[model samples]
Target: MPRRSEAKSGAGSAVRFFVYRSPMKKPNTSPAKATGRCALEWIRPEIRALRAYHVPEGQDLVKLDAMENPYPWPEGLVEKWLDTLRESAINRYPEPSPEALKGLLRKTMRIPDGMGVLLGNGSDELIQLIAMSMQGSRRDKPRVILAPEPTFVMYRLIAMACGLEFVGAPLRAADFSLDGGTVLDAIEKHQPAVVFLAYPNNPTGNLFDTELLLAILAQAPGLVVIDEAYTPFAQTSRMEWLRDWPNLIILRTLSKLGFAGLRLGFAVGHPEWMEEMNKLRLPYNINTLTQASLSLALDHFSVFEEQITRIRQDREKLFRALSAREGVTAWPSRANFILFRPAGKSADAIHAGLREQGVLIKNLHGNHPLLENCLRVTVGTPEENQAFLEALGIVGVK
Candidate 1:
């Protein structure tokens, strides 16, 4: 009964409704989808399940966990460093061998004669290079690395990254001292290929017995890495002993010597061993700017010496202050930081209280078996140290 125009209009309306029901879209099959599928199937097993290391955030607060030097270079010396950088050829790649920096380091650091120098972005990179060189070359033997627990974590982490087995021996709980007898026993059992000993241990801030360290060096079947990152504060070194022990590699850094921003660290060891390690080193690990700046800083070593002296003095003051406090057990420290256990109060609560007061220190509770209820405070300037002591009083025994 409808006219032809009305019927045609009804058909057009039906077609519009069908089009609206199914909205159009581009194809869902994309390059990103294919790439994601490939990644899930082809990623290495070790990396897929890996957990990254946790470094504390909050640098605006008192940063004591990383053990960085709190002082900056004096203004005049900094000006001199700037002048040197102005002349640097930054557009050109840094020297492959970093000869000028090495020469200055050798003279300034008083590196032992005949020992070769190997530079790293930080000591962390050097550790990786050592592990890779050892593992890559010696595939037949079961590659083993040993480190005393409560020492540096990087040694074990690096070894694991290289797919080498890591053995961790425990320190004596009575004083956190090295148990030479136990270490020797472990060496015999495992016949480890690399051993790491942090001279002034972190989170504890106490130096191990040197006599025992020497004893371990004598018996170990493979390379021994002595991490002396805090050597500037301690002022005692075994660099002279490099002449006698070819297996020894002494690691030092400017991080604690007022140049942490530069991230410069080096290893001194027998030339033959370092030669092999150097072959595996990346060509331009040290940047041009860093090399230039470090060379200038080394030329003015007296500034660094003065700053280190102040830190050492401050450390003693902090130690005495911590010892005099009621119920706190502070251990003797040769490094620029002190480690103590809070008495009658929970370390976690004390750490939180300090955080609220805008003063942050390390809380070592449950980090290791021996470090329970312990906290580490880096020796800041006199004013900072006083402020920290005052903050402790506010949070007392609560």
Candidate 2:
């Protein structure tokens, strides 16, 4: 140990700062002796009980596991985009409130007038913010996040991460449609702080009835989030209904529309609610590059619109093909993917067989009891879908 020395600018005519000029000792780099410290012991048990979200490797495969736009940017779009990025202020922080980009989104997504939009790094971050905003808001009871079972997993995962109670009401076993009575009952019981319903629901690929959703919205005691991540393919929205439901907000993302890399997701709702969410949002959460790139892409929004149109057509064709197959039963979908079950094979066997044939898709056999023996495939380019259909036949799923 050594005492500090004084350092002054220009030989001590100024107020000086105290500085330590003592000889420095080499720090110990040896391995620590065990003191019985365990990170799991310190971490929240809810978190400890959860598994990290896993994305299966689809490298060098016709990746249809995740519903992504199968086409790359049209010719010359990439060059035009690079020129725009070159002009962005990379050294400066992005807008704390990105008004121009929000304007572009409002126009592009047809966001209703007078509604406020809050952007997030992605849909997951937006969900986290929604959960955090309601966390600990109730003093007498545990705050809850609710959704239908066999829908999106993030609603529950995010709820757990935020220390809120998660409740999932089951969908009907016959088709993945929401049982309004069951959901209404769950909402009445849980009185969730937020209820997340994925329009054109995930994995199962069927949209819940509109009346059922409105009924749930009417019964819900707190905020309702309609996640329209697949709206481009679904071609329907609840955004217009925002004028009617004060407790409602809708979530949309550019991921399925071919900007997944940019990681932008926005929520449109009343200013009162948006103001509270904006408080928890990290400054510059949407980076300069993302904001610029998405704004420019919206200018060429027609390119995605065309691709979406083609994908919608391909979805029906794929659905018909799966339906025509002798051993498979495919559910109808408003989204760009189809969920089907194979009569003579297990989902694991079929999924692996597709992978071996250089194709990839989701296998949801054990994710829930209702999803048993079920598999989901995204509508891809003609060649990719053909490859998958062929793979399915080869694997005896036909």
Candidate 3:
């Protein structure tokens, strides 16, 4: 490239133009041109080996796959919520402790006085936070995270992501209940730093034997988390047990309680553990909008209570309908969903058939050996539940 000469306005003038030639070839900065192993190499080997969690698309379907409340807020309640949101100061960050919201949750969830509550973007983030907290400065030995097998996938996934070992004890094959002996044995062997118990567990949707859980809690080496995400339908919670078991922490989410879109979850436990977790939490983790919306919703908590009551009723009705169907065995559920197996038909095909018929339910066929041929459907509104049943019938599941 040619350089342009600077024009001299006076006797002496400074040069005003400069030029440089382009490189003969562009530097090979593109990942494809460099070694095959690139930016991913910087990621922890555990994370690199992991597969991203998958959420199937559910557009224009009955949408019963995820265990979300099927009913939307009543129109009047929604207007009130919008009005509350209008007052939220998005320009300012939310309170670090979110004392007002936490107080409401503490009272609503019946968290014992003197207990501490730490909020998260959702229960998913709380799980990750717990995993991170378990990973102390001692990176020499891998910490173990234990949970009953086929319970919740995040317990294992988050553990691995945090470079901790995840140990899953298999539940009794007969009824998807915890095998206390096996779990205790595994606890002794693994000496895990954390144990996750999904109360009224997912996929299977049955509450584990309370005695077995108490046994596990007694023997656990470190913290024990009782995830009560579905407690609204189950009508049970362990939040009040914090005084009895210092090692116990209760995880609850407003997600299943019909605030899923707001993505608010709270972890209630002794302050010792809560303080440690707060250290690792990023500032403003829960945004101002979420805080304001949650405050308004908590004010009208009765609305969600009504919805949950209806879901519990629908759960029983759906269970009965499933049990009455031929070639189908539906498990009893305390949560807002049912797990059932279809005889003389492929669960995968049945799931697809349901999809084809414009209904969506979870197919747990290959997720775990215990979950083989099992499908879970969230209890929806009466019409939606009826539509799902009709689709299930069309799939030859009857």
Local distance difference test, each candidate: 0.84, 0.90, 0.88
Q: List the residue pairs that clash in candidate 2.
A: none
Sort order, lDDT high to low = 2, 3, 1
lDDT of 1 by residue, 221-293 (tens): 8999898988888888888989999999999888878777888889999999889999888889999988888
Per-residue lDDT of candidate 3, residues 167-208 (tens digit): 899988878888888999999998899999999898788888
Number of the top-ranking candidate, with TM-score as the measure: 3
Q: Estimate the overall C-alpha local distance difference test score of candidate 2.
A: 0.90
Q: What is the TM-score of each candidate against the true structure?
A: 0.87, 0.90, 0.91
Pairs that collide in candidate 3 are none
Each prediction's RMSD over C-alphas, in Å, is 9.4, 6.5, 5.5
lDDT of 1 at 350: 95
> Which stretches of model 3 miss by more than 4 angstroms?
1-27, 34-36, 136-140
* Candidate 3 vs. true structure, TM-score: 0.91
